[model samples]
Target chain A: MKKLVQDDIRTGVFICDCGSNIAGYLEMKELVEFAKTLPNVVFVQENLYTCSEGGINEIKLAIPRENLNRVVVASCTPRTHEPLFMSACEEGGLNPYLFEMANIRDQCSWVHMREREAGTQRAKVQIAMAVAKAAKLRELNRIQLSLSHRALVIGGGVAGMSAALALANMGYEVDLVEKRDRLGGILNELNMILPSNEPPDKLVNNLAARLHDNPKVTIHTGAVVTKTEGYVGNYVATIRQNENENKIKCGAVIVAIGAQPLKPEGLYNYDGKKVITHIELESKLKQGDVQAKNISIIQCVGSRSKERTYCSRICCMTAVKNAILFKEASPDTKITIFYRDMQMYGVENEQLFRKSKRLGVRYVTYDPDRPPRFDGESVSVHHLRMGRDIIVPTDLLVLSTPLVAQDDASEISTMLKVPINENGFFLEGHVKLKPLDFATDGVYLCGNARFPSTIREAISQGLGVASRAAGVLSKEALFTSGIVADINPETCCGCLGCVAVCPYGAINFIENRGICQVNKVLCKGCGGCAATCPSGSARLDGFSNQQIYAQIEQAMAV
Target chain B: MSDSQFEPKIVGFLCNWCAYAGADLAGVSRLQYPPNMRTIRTLCSATVGPHQILKAFQKGADGVFVGG
Candidate 1:
């Protein structure tokens, strides 16, 4: 690893035209001239497209040619293009973290298109700030930690089973833990799945049998993850089962604990007898026990309201499937489904809705403001199209409620140091970029634990999370960011502020020395502790206060 | 406020996770704001100390905004 000597810093600044997206609004030549005047900037180049092949080649060749150790690219947003420029810098024999980016196109010219003079001036200032920060930038090596080659799957439902199987099949040992004594989870209670109308038992049986037969997979029923320690690539988990605690070591974890059905206790006069939730109805339907001649299903029971803002995503399809099932059981049994909007997303769900209609199931669209009133044996709904109140006599009323996060989700989230969303589901790292991963590196999320999902979607996410977890387990070692927090013992006052403010628990107080120490392997490079340290003893490796002050001084310089 | 020639040299400390992303979003959406501000990116808002803000003002910055 090459260490960066700040005093002898050689910085290169690459300004991009972005194909006139930036040049159209500002004078490119003036910005280049301004960049060269900045301190420590030895090389300056302007490209038509810095992200293009030719532009990248120019950067790759310039590092050795100019002896540039720190590179700054004044291009587009780093969110989309930072990785590209960082890799290009790495190819040029510079550390990937030794590069910085300034958004000249998006944050400047594009936004202030009409103000050419002001935008150009602002661009110059932005470039100056990048160069200023670049001069103080340090080369950092990635922190690599060995993997255990074993995975912990935290549920035995459809999602958990699928993830376990995916990992085990890929030659990695798996530990599948279920809270319930059975491995099927909620699937065991479900009657039949949509589209195919296949028995849920068959799916569960196949998954359970395969999991039981796999030598690489270990099944622990009625087990709960009691405690978790360590960081990514090295996790120690304590599983409690049958009054005994067993410790397991694994590289990554897949959280697929799933969700529970919301019980609409008061609203719609639900007694769990006459007006029962869909879960109860599904069980009865599965056992061939439903004897009602006239059945009514209401959608958005506890969801799509002021309290619960999000659509459950799967309940509308579930209601459609259940309605169709009733119509199939006995042709004389009339089934009516009242919903605000039919959320049959994919082709299969749409087909299920169409088939339900074909099977003579009545579909009614109702206004949310004027919800149907249940009176034990009957429901009175204001017909939107008909503009009249119609009373339908029903023997059983099924409330199609959304799935809510488990009560212990917060407890588990605390144990793992992961976050849950406002809706209480596990928050992914990024909605699109990292759908299967948590912000924490080692932990992954799938199935209804992230959001309400169908069995098929859950299984798909299970496989997706399995692949992500396997990527870490299969690697010889996992490398983390090197720009982490560092404590200077010389300037130390052991206040323990950094220890408290650190979200990753990377800081620890050295009791004997009366100083603070940073666990580099656990530090996420977030720099929370650095800013909170009263003595200014803790500072991030690359983003030290000196570097930031330099950038600030240059940025505000007239 | 009415002086056209008085272009305020403002310094902004933006966090990499949120504020920087928000700024990028504004640019991607073509939302325009004042061009007087110069931004320095930090790993987190917590990383920006009081002295950094003081340094900006001491260096003749008219205004300073610390965004996470």
Candidate 2:
């Protein structure tokens, strides 16, 4: 890309109506007249929909005709439409980085629909700010990175296995590492899988067999990933086995280290023998050693409290499943479940809940303030419906505890350079849109590591995670944004504040030169280091300090 | 200027990922608010330096909001 001097800065402003989305609320003619008055704004045009084909062509044609050095589109948010305008500018012989955008529809028109005058004034100010920033906009080039074709699957759980299988089937080499001697993860201890009613080992064995037979997959048991370095396309990880450390390079990583159920040690006087968790009952039931004639189950044992606030989504269904199973095995066993609220979500779980009631399983809603009390033989609880204290004969007390994040979740999050929520679960990029991906490009997560998920959801997430990783692995080369930060070597004082505050580890201190430098490939353009640099040396290329100040000055002037 | 005649000027620096997306969502949902704030979309909240904020104030901005 060719660079242009400040004297050649000719900015063209395109105001968009968005097909009555913006025109219905704001005065378009006034905004256009206002945009024309801005400094260096040589051309101004109004579009019905700047993202439409005809609108884009007008931009392309106007660029060469008007000799535009910078293009500013005052339209809907740049989040969705910026790329279209930028590409149009590129086709018109202008660099894409020279394009700037102002959000008139989203920020002004839609927000102040009733206030026409005020909204138009706001749009004018936004256009002026964008034009001011455009005057200082510089062309930036994208950096292409080499990609590794292999993938790494951490934690050989159901999700991990599914991800590995999917990736291997895609003709990519996959390395699956499991910390335990076996590959099933939480599936090994589970008695019967839901929805299918098959034994847990059956699914585990089937996946393991498929993974083992595939030539692209290499399974490592009793192995853990101790270190992972690099970004999306190229990652190097060290797997630590008993005494040996083996290093493997892969393009993407899938985290499926499933969570563990809380033991409820002190709560409900849990002894693991008489007062045991629901998971403990699964083992006893599997062994055919559940000898109790009467069983009373307690829900929300160690969750939904001041400490652990989130309601573990799957625990209620687990309680219902166990209740139904126990009732079917021994019809005479008096089983009562005391819960604050039955969170049986979806059609299957609701059907299971109704079936449990049909099988003579009793459900009593107990207040958390006044919980059920056990005196070694019978359980006493205040029934909300009856408005009286009731006693139920109980020999085996089963506590259904929520599944918490894995013990080493924080360690893995740090090693991956990803973030974790306060509950220690790995946080995804966006809660709704990008559920299976981390903020970092290459790393993805699924199963209980993200949240307490059912076995079916975990498998689906595993497959979904593989697809997300493949989105990167399938690409021959990856291009990073040109908006990365750069430090002036002359002005750097080696304060290391930028280094200390960088979340992505993109900046490195040069000990020999006593300065800090930015690795452009690793930079995500968050600009944390640029703001923290006291000497004003570190400046993000696109969002320079001068550009932002110019914008503020323009905004205040209006 | 009279108290009622003087309209306060506010500049907001909205981060691209969160607050800016949220503002866009508000627009998509047609959630109305007073047109009292002028926004600048930034890559991150940290990109808004103290110098830029003081400059906004020095240029006669009544208030500044940095949202991530």
Candidate 3:
């Protein structure tokens, strides 16, 4: 890393037209002339496309010729183009962190296309601000930490087991933890799975057998993760079982603790015997303990309500699958399914729905406002399509309730420093791009822990999380941002204001020195601690007090 | 009407994650607004100190917006 001294603060500003995206709306020539007047701006140039190869070469050649220590690009957003410009600076024998970006295209030209005069003036002011900030830019160093090759897989269900098997197949050591004495989770109570009509036991047993036989896999039953510490590439987990506690160090963690089935007790007149949840019915069917002639299955129980507004992704299919099983077992028995909407997604599930209809399974659509009433021995539902009431004498009532998040979800979320949605599901980084990964770098989520999913969806997410975790564990070392918060011992009075406001718990008071300190590795460079410090003692490295004030002062310049 | 139009000189501090993306989206969608604001991009909203806002106001900014 190169230290940019005050005497060598020569900043070269480059303006890009973006092939008329910016030039069409604002005058580039006038903006370049305006940039040269700013302090420390030794060179100013305009390009047709600043991100192009020729434009990058022009910047590389100008650094040594102009004696430029800091480079500023007045163009597109820094979110997408900052890295490209930073790498270009590094190639030009300058510190990458010394480069600053001003979003003239997104914030100025493109926003004020009709008002060209105002747009040009705004672009000039933005360039001035960039030059002012560039004068105070400092070089930053990247911190690298070695990674542990092992992984910790929480939960021993099909999702957890599948992830463990995949990681173990990749020649990585895996520790699988289950809170119960057995391996299978909710799958243990399930009789048959959807789309295949196959016994879930077969799938669960297959995963359990492979996990047990794998030399790289270690199974820990009746255990819970008591504590977790450290960041990505290095995480220490303390697991406790019975009266013993064990510590495991791993690079990545996959949370597949799954979810518990919702039990609508008083809502559906459920007595746990006559009117019961789908989970209870499934266990009874598995043991051949249920006997009924007339069965009524209700969908969206305790889900898609005002309180829990999210759709339980797999409840409708489960209801259809169970209804088909009952019809197949006793052809004379009448099975009716009352639903708001049939969520039979995918080709296989739609085919199963059609097959169930052909096998004499009756379906009745009901309104959410007028729900079905279970009057002791029968269920009366207000049919939406018919616009009338239909009463069915129910011998057995099965409510297909949505899966609720585990009780320990919030506790686990706090321990891992990951976020949970309002519905209590673990929030992924991105719904589409990063489905199995958490916002936190090393942690991953899958299965019902994120949302209610089928056995197939859960298994697919399990494999996806395994691949994501392997990507992190495969790296030799991890590099973190260098623009972390730094506390000045001379100005710090140990007020602990920064310590109280730090969301990441990165700030701590040094009792011996009577000053606050920051863990640079844990600090995300968010600047929360620095902003909350009353004494102005805490400061971010690259974005210091002088750098921001300079930009603010330049913004107000005539 | 007055000879000089009163254009509000606003200083905006936009966070890189959401607000910056939102501003870029507005430009991409060709949405128009008053061209009276100057933006300073930061890594996060938590990075913008109280002094930064006070400094903008002291430097003759009519309004200030802090976005995350």
Candidate number with greatest lDDT: 2
Best by TM-score: 3
Better of 2 and 3 by TM-score: 3
Pairs clashing in candidate 3?
Answer: none
Clashing pairs in 1: none
User: Each candidate's lDDT (Cα)?
Assistant: 0.88, 0.91, 0.89
- Top DockQ prediction, candidate number: 2
The TM-scores of all predictions, comma-separated, are 0.92, 0.89, 0.92
Model 2 lDDT, residue B62, Cα: 97
Task: Provide the lowest-lDDT 10-residue window in model 2 chain A.
Answer: A1-10
Comparing 1 and 3 on TM-score, the stronger one: 3
lDDT of model 1, residue A221: 97
C-alpha DockQ of every model: 0.78, 0.79, 0.77
User: What DockQ score does model 2 reach against the true complex?
Assistant: 0.79
Candidates 1 and 3: which is better by DockQ? 1
Tens digit of per-residue lDDT, candidate 2, span A1-558: 112235678888988899999999999999988777777778999999888999999999999999999999999999998888889999999999999999999888999999999999999889888988998889899999899989999999999999999999989999999999999998888788666778898999999999999999999999999999887889999999998998999999999998999989788778999899988898888898889989999999889998999999888998998888888888888899999999998898889999999999999999999999998899999998889999999999999899999899999998998899999999999999999999788899999899999988999999999999999999999999889999999999999999998877899999999999999998889999888899999999789889998889888887
On lDDT, the stronger of 1 and 2 is 2
Scored against the true structure, residue A549 in model 1 reaches a CA lDDT of: 83
RMSD of every prediction? 3.5, 3.8, 3.3
Tens digits of per-residue lDDT for model 1, B1-68? 67977888888888888998898888888898978888787778888878888888898898998888
For model 3 the local lDDT of residue A430 reads 93
